[model samples]
Target: MKTTIAVLGAGSWGSVLASVLVQNGHQVRLWTRHPQQAAELNNQHTNQHYMGDYQYPPQLQTLTNLAAVLKNAEVVLFTVPTPAIRSVAEQVVPILHAQKACPLIVHASKGLEQQTHLRISEILTATIPAPYRQEIVALSGPSHAEEVARKDITLITAASTSLAAAQQVQRLFMNNYFRVYTNTDLIGVELGAAFKNVIALGAGALHGLGYGDDAKAALMTRGLAEISRLGVALGAQPLTFIGLSGVGDLIVTCTSIHSRNWRAGNQLGQGKKLTAVIKDMGMVIEGIKTCQSAYELARAQNIDMPITEAIYHVLYEQADIKQEITALMQREGKSESY
Candidate 1:
């Protein structure tokens, strides 16, 4: 069945998703804050700045007016960064309130709000009213926008408290090259999606510092342990960590050159300042902010996350990365299955 979809944001992921939805035979209106971006995407059918020469489907519409984009939309998919989700949701609230029927709300963003530490769905629920906020779903997994743009064989999980809602998203996004699975563990999916970015940052740092595969393998293995611990503490299912959003996302984000988070960490590992790295990347490295939120959450919950703690210090406290690694290595060892 065809759907009228409103895709928020014009970043690489957002643009690629809009293109995919167009390919899926949906009426996709991609909303961007900048008029120039909208005009370029609409007229040129390409987003060269972010997507790097990939041609978007000409059917994909780009718009600056939020109200216009939301008009008669059946699904509102937010592809904005975590920090911008609330602001965008606040804008969508009044428009949605005027509508007769509520659209299915879905988000591809993966990060916790800095202060509240809320997931994207929680932020949507808090900002959007009950009528418009029904059946919120999170679309996540080891998906890189560049690869997905090339029609790579990508598998992801669409998670929601409502199984039907998850299935709906699964149907909307699933294709021959892109597959979607439904998972009921919303908390686990969101946590796995967010926490893995932090781990990917660490993995990139390891690479930038010239650490071999053994070091990265150790970091990834133990990083999954840390993610699973905090995730379970926050009420996520244990098995979800090993699923697509958890281990799968972690591996791709940490290893792939397409990952902004991993690239940011690599720059940081090479002794560049965080500000410089972020500025140079020209994209949102979610792990930078997520590392802070996760660090605070872990500390408050009394969760033992040495890798997170180490990354947090390196990013925020101006601590020497080498020294932090030394401290981590010097800590008393314990059984792998604690």
Candidate 2:
């Protein structure tokens, strides 16, 4: 079953995903907003700015016209940033309507809409036409673009309310090196992906402050607890936190140097301002935005998420990171409860 897939976004994750699809014998056409990037990928088989020396599959193609690629694509994968999801979905609506085709919608983004606090799947459901809305699956895990590009063994979750939708994604990408697991817990998978980034920020900040290894471990552990609490409060399964999209993701994003969010937090811990860190990263550090949205969501739902609140204050309110840490430590202790 060779599928024609249209991958939206040419960032690190997007390009790598396109390459993997090409390797699986799918006709992959990457949609990039920048003409130069598309031209480079087509001509040199390398996206130096995003992928860095990783050779794209020779069969992969790049296109700037979204409608052209949507022409025959059986699957539309979104690897864009949270802020861009809405606009991109809006752009795809008429194209799908015009084509009279319904493709399996898969979103790999790991952030919520800042204003609406909606997950990527929810955003797409609201933005795209009803005809194209069957089951939007979320593909997420600890798998980073760099490691996946290197053909490292990676595991991820494909979650959707529709089991068929999830299995469709699993068969589309799973291989010897990449394993995909299907779960019907859409809320859990989506929240796990988004909230883990918030926790990863705190983890990176601790590392930047030269905290002890035990402190980092405690943060990661407690961070998982906080993520679980908030996620369950928001209608997600608690056990999902222990899965690849949850604990698995938190471990990699918090400790790996390849994580832009962790690197951004490291800069903040090293006494750099938020604006300066964002400017220097040259990439969208999703944790910063997810911190804001998740903080607001917790408050709105009366959910207790101390770590999320702490990172939000540090990133947006200019609160002293150490003071936030001290406050977190000084809070009334609870009996190791989630």
Candidate 3:
């Protein structure tokens, strides 16, 4: 069955997802705020700035008008950055409220709102009225846009409080190259999605600091511990931390050059300023902001996340990376079984 989908955001992830929808025979209308980006996607069928040399499916239409994109769409997927999710949700509220039937709201963003410390799904639930919303789903995993663009096999989890909603998204995106799984632990899935980025930043810094595999292994392992700790504290299932959105995302983002967060951390490890690293990346490095949010949340929850604390100090306090690492190592040793 063919469905009309409205994809908000025209970046690499958004364009790649819209292309996937088109390939799946859905009517995909991607929304972009920039006129030039919209024109490029509409006329040239390319989003050169994000997905270099990767031509989008011509069936994928790009538009600047949100109303037109949302018109008769059965699903509205948001691929915007974490910071923009709330604002975009606010913008979609009035338009969605006017529709006779509420569309399933799905978000692929993988970070928490900084100040409020709310997950993407929570933000959507708070902003979108109940009458205008059917279900909120989070689509996340280790999948990267570049790899997906190359038709590499990608598996992601579609998490919702409603199993039916998760199954719906699974059917929508599953194909030859893309695979989807359903998980009902919405809290666990969202936390795993958001917190893994913080661990990835630390993993990249370990590489940047000339650490060997032993050190990287230690950072990643302990980082997973921190992720699981904070995640469980926030009502996430313990098992979800070992699944795709948790350890899976951490492995890919920490080890791959394709990750903007890892790349930014590498620059920071090379002694570059955070501002310069972010400016040069030409994209949002979500972990930097997410680290702060996680640090604050961990403190509030009384969860001890030493790795997150170390990375937070390095990124926010301008602490020397080496010094932070030393500080981490010098902390009182405890049994790993804790």
Of the candidates shown, which would achieve the greatest lDDT relative to the real structure?
1
For each candidate, what TM-score against the reference?
0.99, 0.98, 0.99
Q: Give one digit per residue, the lDDT tens place, for model 3 in 70-157.
A: 9999999999999999999999989987866599999999899978999999999999998888899999999999999999999999
Clashing pairs in 1: none
Error of 1 at 31 (Å): 0.3
Report the C-alpha lDDT of model 1 over 1-338, residue by residue, as the tens digit: 99999999999999998898899989999999999999889888889889978989889999999999999999999999999999999999988887765999999999999899999999999898887766899999999999999999999999999999999999998899999999999999999999999999998998899999999999999999999999999999999999999999999999999999899888888999988998999888899999999999999999999999999999999999889999999999799985
TM match of model 2 to true structure: 0.98
Error of 2 at 75 (Å): 0.7
C-alpha lDDT of candidate 3 relative to the true structure:
0.91
Q: In candidate 2, what residue range of length 10 has the lowest lDDT sum? A: 126-135
lDDT of 2: 0.91
Ranking by lDDT: 1, 3, 2
Candidates 1 and 3: which is better by lDDT?
A: 1
Task: Please give the clash total of every predicted structure, in order.
Answer: 0, 0, 0
